[model samples]
Target: MSTRTYLPYIACAAALCVAQARADVKIGFSAPLSGPVAAVGQDQYDGFLLGLESVGGKLGGQVTTVLREDDQLKPELGNQITRKFIDRDKVDAMVGLGFSNVLMASLPRIAESGTVAIATNAGPSPLAGAGCLPNVFSTAWQNDGTAEAMGKYAQDTGFKRVYLMAPNYQAGKDYIAGFKRHYKGQVLDEVYTQVNQPDYAAEIAQLQAAGADAVFVFYPGGMGVNFVKQFSQAGLGKKLPLLSAFTVDGTTLPALRDAALGTISGAMWDVALTTPGNAEFVATFAKKFGRTPSHYAAVGYDAARLLDIAVRKVHGKTADKAAFAAAVKAAGTELKSVRGPFRFNTNNMPVQNYYAFQTVKDGEKFGVKLLGTPLSQHQDVYVAQCGAK
Candidate 1:
C-alpha cells in the first residue's frame, strides 16, 4: 500500500460519484397498451413522446429514458408493473395510467417509493378527496368534472328526463354522481354495464323504451366505439338527444364516422380549440401521427411538459423529494397546456374549462368541434376534501 496507489483509488471513486450524479433521468410509463383501451393508451404514449421531442429528447437539460409497460387495464397487473419500474428499472418518475382502477392500485406503491406520478387520463374521485397524495398529480380532469359539465348543459337545454349508462366501475360511479350533482332533471333510469361489453343492444333497447328526453353516458376507448355504433344502429342517436363525456373523442370518433355525428359531449380539449398551443399541438400531432389526437393525448402531452418544467426547476435532481415536489407544484399552473389555462386544484387534479363539443363531419371524417363552454374555470368539488390549499 503505497500512498500513490491510495490516491489512484480515491480519484476513481470520485469519478464514479460524478458519473452517478449525472446519470440519465429515467421515466416509467404504464398503461393498457394491449387491451380494449389500447388505442387510447397508444395515443397517450405518442403524445408524451411528442412532448419529449419538443424538448429535444431531454428534460431539464438531462437526457431522459422512458420505459413503457402495459398494464392490460388490470389493477393488480398495474401494481406489479409499478413495483418493477421502481425496484428493477429504478425510474426517477412515472407517467400514464389510463384507467381509475389501475391508477388507484398503483398509487400506494408509487407513494411508498416517493416517486412522482403524473396521471394522463383517469382521475378517480377518492384520490381527489381523502386519498389525495402530494406525489400524485393528474394532467387530466377528475372523473366527474367533465360529466358535471355535460349535466349542467343538459339541465340548461331543458331536458326533463334523461337515461344514464356507464360501465360498472369506480369511474362509472363517479361519472354518474357528477352528472347528478349538476343535472336537476329527473333520471329515468341508471344502467351499469360491464367494462368491455361489446354489444349494447340490451342497454339501447332499454334506452329506447325509457322514453327519456336525453341520454347521458360515460364510455371510453373501445367500449365507446361499440356503444356509439350500436346506438346509431338502434336509431336511439336520432330519437333521443345523446350527451356524454369521455365517450366520443378523437380516439373513438374516427371509428364511428357518421354514427357519432351530432353527438354532444363535454371535454376539456378538442382539436378545434382556439389557442396557439392547441393549434400547434393539433397540427404537429396530425403531421406526426397522421391522425387527430384525443383528449387523453392532450393530457399526456401536458403531463410531459409539466414534468419538464418541474425537472428544470429542480435541475433534474429528483432525489431531493421536497424540492422536487415544490418544483412540481410551482410548475403546475405554468406549463404551456394544449387545453389552455391549466392549473391543479388542491387535490392535484386539474382546474380548467369544460366545453360542450359536438361530433361533426370534418372532411368526410368525424371529429369533435367545440360548441361552447359549459363550465368555465371549473375546480372539482373534491378539492376541499383533500385538505390541501
Candidate 2:
C-alpha cells in the first residue's frame, strides 16, 4: 500500500531529476577524436555543426560557439578534458556526446554543475534508469533499444542459437542485455574483449569452435572495423550469421567494405532514411564530406535540432535548466524522428521504432540497407517503470 514499497529508487531519481532542470543555457560539444574512435567523433561533430549552420550559429537569443575536445577514449583523459571544458571554456551546456565510457566518467561533473547535456549519442541504460539525471536529455536511444531490435529479428527469423560478443564496458553490457531481452534462444557463448582491441583472432577461433547458428555483437567506432575484418579473417563469416547494434556504422563501414557483407544491424536512423529532413541531411553531409551518414550523424543532427527547439521555446531565456529540459523532452515528443516517429519516456530516452538493416554491396559502393519490421515501435518500457502519472 506504500509508494516506496511499490516503486524502485530509480523511479524516485527520475522524478528528482525532472524537478531540478528548470534555468541559462550555453551548450558544449564533447566527443572522441585523434584516436581509434575519431571517425565516430568527427561524424557526430559534423552533424552538430550542420545543425548550427541551419540556425546561423545562434541558439535562442544567445550566440553559441561549440568547444570541441578529444576524449582519446580514456576514462582519465575524458575526465580531464571535461573539467577543462567546464572550467575554462565557460560553456553553459553540453552536446554531441560520442561514446559511453567517456560520457560515464564525465556525467557526475555535468550533474554537479547542473549543465544541461544534450546526450547526442551513447545512451547507457543506467542513465535511462537508476542514474537518470535531469540536466542530461538524450537525443538518441539507449544501446539496449537498438540491440533489442536485432534480438527480435533473430527470434522472428528462427535463429535457435546465438553467440554474442562486445568490448567490455558499460555500453557493451547494455548491448548484450538488450539482445537477451528479446532473444530467448540458447546462447552458445558470450565473449567480452578489451575495449577497442585491434585483434579478434582468439575470440574468433572460440566463436568458430562454438558453432552458433548466429552471432550478435556491439562493437562501435574502430572496434567494429577491427572485429569485422577479423571475423572475416577467422572465417566465421562463412560459418555464422551476424547481427549487430553499433558494430558497423557510417564511420566504420567504409573500412569494413567486403568484410561486413551480410551483417545485420539495428538503429533509429540511417543515411537511407526516406524522410525529407533525413534526405536533406544526407545530401548535405555527402556533399560537404563526400560520404553517406551513419546513425552518429543523425544523432548529432537531432541533438542540434533538439537544442534549437529548447532555445526557441523560451525565446531569449536559457538560464532556466528545468525549462530547457522540458523543451528538449517536448521536442522529442513527436512523429518526425529521423527513422520515423519518435517519442520520449520519463527516463529522458527515446520511445521510437527499431530499424533493421543489413550491410550489402550496391553497385560500386557498400552500405547498410533497410530490411525488416520495427521491434519496439515508438515505445520504451521505461516510462511505465517511471510511473510519471
Candidate 3:
C-alpha cells in the first residue's frame, strides 16, 4: 500500500471520469426501415447520415452515435421502439418518425421523457394544434399544408370538378380536408382506400367513372408508386390531369420513372430549386447516394442541421433542459436550409413555400421540375390553435 500505487489508482480514476464526460452524443432514429414505405424511411435516414458526414461525423465538436430502429410502419411497434430508446438507449434526442400514425403513437412517450423529437416528416394535425408539445418539432410541413397548396392551385387553374382520393388514415383525411378547404370547386367524388392496398384498378375505374375534370390524390411511399403506375397503365395519365401532394417525389419518382411523367404535385422542396445550400446538398447527396435526394431527404437533412446548430449554441451541454430547448428553438431558422429560408411556426411546423412541381424527363433520368409556387411563405392554419411559443 505505497503512496506511488495509491497515486496511480487516483490518476486512472480521474482519466476515466474525464473520458466519460466527453462521451459521444446519442441520438435515436426510429422509422419504417423495412416495409412498403421503406424507401421513404431509407431516404430520410440516408439524408441524416449525409448531414453528419458533411460535418465529419460530429456535431458541435462532439461525436454522435445514432441508434436506428425500424418501426415497420406500425404504430404499436413505433411506441415500443420509442420506449426502448428513452429507457434503454438513453438517447438525448430523437429524429425520423415517418408516418403520422407512428408519430401519434410515439409522441406521448417522447414528451413524457422530456426528450426532444424532431420530425423529418409526419406533421400530424393533432400535434400541430391542441396536442402540441414543446418537446416536439417538425422540420417538414404540416400534413395539410402541402395538400392545401395543391388544392388552391387546382382551384385557380379552373378545375371545376375534381375527384379526391387518399388512404384511409389520419394523414389521408388531413390531405383531403386541406384540399377541400381551398378548392372552392365542385367535388365529383371522394375515395379512401386501404393504406397498403396494392391494386388501384377498382379505384382507377371509379376515378374514370366519376367524370371529374381533374383528380387530386395523396398517396405516399409505395402506395404512390403503385397508384401512379396503375393510373398510367389504365391510360388515364394523359386523359385526365393528375394533381397531388406527397404522391410523386424523390422516393417514388425513380420507381415510377416514365409512369410518373406529367404528374403534378406540391412539395416543400424540389431538386430544381436554386440556392447555394440546395445546390451543394443535391450534388453531394447524389454523389454519395448515387441518386437524387427526395423532399423527405431534404427535410431530414434540415433536421440534422437544426440539431447541430442547437448543440453548438448550447455548447453541447444538452443536459441543461431549459438551455437546450431554448437553443433548439433559436436554431430553427439559423441554419442554411436547403429549402431556402425556413422558420418554424408557433406549432413548431415549418412556415415555408410549397412549390408546384411536375415529374419530367431530365436528360436520361426522370426528375422533378419546379413549375410554380402555389403557397408562398405559407403558415399552417393550425399554428393559431397551438398555444406554444
TM-score of each: 0.93, 0.89, 0.93
Model 1 agreement with the true structure over 1-389: per-residue lDDT tens digits: 00000011134533211222233678888888887789889899889878876775567767677778889998999899889888887877888965998998888888887778888888899999988888888898899999999999999999999999999999999999999999998999899999889999988888888889999999999999999999999877778789999889888877888888899999999888996688898899999899989988898888888888999998878888667777887898788788878888888898899999998875776666778998998998988889863
Q: Against the true structure, candidate 3 has what lDDT?
A: 0.84
**Local distance difference test, per candidate?**
0.84, 0.75, 0.84
List where candidate 1 sits over 4 angstroms from the true fold.
Answer: 1-23
> lDDT by residue for model 2 over 1-389, one digit each (tens)?
00000111244543221222212344567777777888888888888776655654555534555667777777777777667667776566677665788788888887787667877777777777777877776778876888889888999899999999998999899889888998999988889999879898888888888868999998888888888898888777766888988788788888988888998888888866686678887888888778888788788877777677778887857667677667777777642556677767777777777889888898978977789655755555454454341
Clashes of 2: 16
Clashing pairs in 1: none
Q: How accurate locally is residue 18 in candidate 3, as Cα lDDT from 0 to 100?
A: 22
**Number of clashes recorded per candidate:** 0, 16, 0
Indicate the worst ten consecutive residues by lDDT in candidate 1.
Answer: 1-10
The whole-model C-alpha lDDT of candidate 2 against the native structure comes to 0.75
